[model samples]
Target: MPLFKRRDGGSIRDRFEFRDVLGTGAFSKVFLAECKAEPGHLVAVKCIDKKALKGKEESLENEIKVLRKLRHQNIVQLYDTYDEKGYVYLVMELVTGGELFDRIVAKGSYTEKDASHLIRQVLHAVSFMHDNGVVHRDLKPENLLYFNHEEDSKIMISDFGLSKTEDSGVMATACGTPGYVAPEVLQQKPYGKAVDIWSIGVIAYILLCGYPPFYDENDANLFAQIIKGEYEFDAPYWNEISDSAKDFISHLMCCDPDQRFTCEQALAHPWISGNTAYTKDIHGSVASHLKKSLAKRNWKKAYNAAAAIRQLQLLRISSSRAVTGNSSSNGTPPNRPFPV
Candidate 1:
């Protein structure tokens, strides 16, 4: 049989020389490796212990099945697979550009145009996958990788460990990161490609504003926020963002999947189509917001009652902004976090 069909003739240790471990999880460890036969050829080797996979074989099989059939510039390439007595190894492309926000935070100057280009590639890859009947189910910052350390390096969507390939066009699996999970996923309803759209909306929102749409220290509160499909683009954060960009996110984060935008439709959106005209200097505000948000989350325990009152003041300002505009809330409930 061809190598693609099976690499069972010899041990994977004979093929690639393993280097430092890149990452680790409950059942698998990803390591940086070099092809022994082709010196300097680096790859990521994800090794999963069979014993650890006893109950999760379905996920692994689903990942492999989907990856084997996918070939795109934005999606990470799966080079080969090998199985040993106790473990299954996946050989994949090695990416070094780092996660989505890391790169954005690294660049001294970034903008809506740059974010648009990045998301365009992701949408294209997603369009291809949906066209082929595969759903990535899990789309988050950690899963998006860059090909190299260069500022212009390409983004590759990695980590299909939770991906599923189904012909039914709808699935009932409740798996994904808590922060970026779609409303339908939390509701345990049968869903489809629209879930990926929701994830992309969250990503795009962060890209433009440097903060997650829904956030709460309490997981239950966070889930409640997501299930309501309500989030705000407050002033100072969203004031600099373009209306077209906001419109794009509005279409994706809809609570009803049937009403959400599809990949093809998103690609043709005005913000994506006219990216060249977007603001080119949005890094300062976003970076500041990220720093502030991180500091606030980390030092919450140190804040006194005065700080709590200050938070209430911020919400009041947000409310006043709502009232001054003489416009209704963006479907926000009376009890929701005052738009801040």
Candidate 2:
């Protein structure tokens, strides 16, 4: 049985006609729907089968809860929801603009100043989320979207499947994409809103350059590197990036969550305030690397989502078994030195 009651209503289809499929994932299908009363306005309705969400109802419900109350210019808006016998549907704002990376690549000229502006907007949204006691556990390029196909549309943060609200305080779920995840999360430590800041730092590093700060084919190796907070700005790609830009990333990538910058602090940083002249167009170089990066999508990404869920389960089981907090307690030592 669903945790929440369906708001009294007629056939959902009578009021909202599904037009076309927007996207599909393992748990849900997002469709472009037309409103009967406001036919001119179209909304994206995410349909999730109750059977498919048998074990994951908590996450889905938390996502709906967060989306229902949280509203920001850079965050996708949830219009309404319906709890039918077979499935639940969440109606959201329809955004036509493409992914953030694609939009940057399409631009003729992109620069650090441009990157700062983008990060600033993301920070504002994240700041608002934190203020409202919500943490977006999964913050990545794929989750960032533009409002429209317009050249200057604002990026909206989408996909809250892994989000955690204040009610679930000091989350230890260990759920999120591998690369952009905070080190504390990788270590399975009790974490708070700072995880979102770490993710923003990763996004900032990518926005300025075009590739992730941490990249590896070996999952263990990648996790170890993240644990150590080891990363470098390689030649050719990062040669032109400013030190201030790197400094900004450094502030957030600290291994200790206590040392990382909060969204408010990040927003007030000099880089976002235009202290450095990062206006020189890095689009030519960045777009080239970005194209290759996006096309050669990491195989681990598909596996990581499942792995995160498994990791979560393992953690729960371990807690029941009273396993030590140290990652090494599981026998696979997480402290193994990362290959340089």
Backbone clashes in each candidate structure, one number apiece? 0, 0
- In angstroms, give how far residue 65 of model 1 lies from its true place: 0.8
lDDT score for candidate 2 against the true structure: 0.79
Error of model 1, residue 239, in angstroms = 1.0
The prediction achieving the highest TM-score against the true structure is 2
Which residue pairs show collisions in model 1?
none
**lDDT for every model?**
0.77, 0.79
Candidate topping lDDT: 2
Q: Candidate 2, 340: how far from true, in Å?
A: 19
> Which pairs of residues collide in model 2?
none
Judge candidate 1 against the unseen true structure and give its global Cα lDDT, from 0 to 1. 0.77
Clashes of 1: 0
lDDT of 1 by residue, 1-340 (tens): 2123453577789989999999998789999999999999999999889898988776677788899989998999999988677888999998888877767777899889888988899999999999988888889876888889986899999888777777744687677776677877766678888989999999898888777787655344555567776588877678778888989999988989999999999999988877543766999877766655544544333332234334535555332232233222333334322211
Q: How do the predictions measure up, each by TM-score? A: 0.83, 0.88
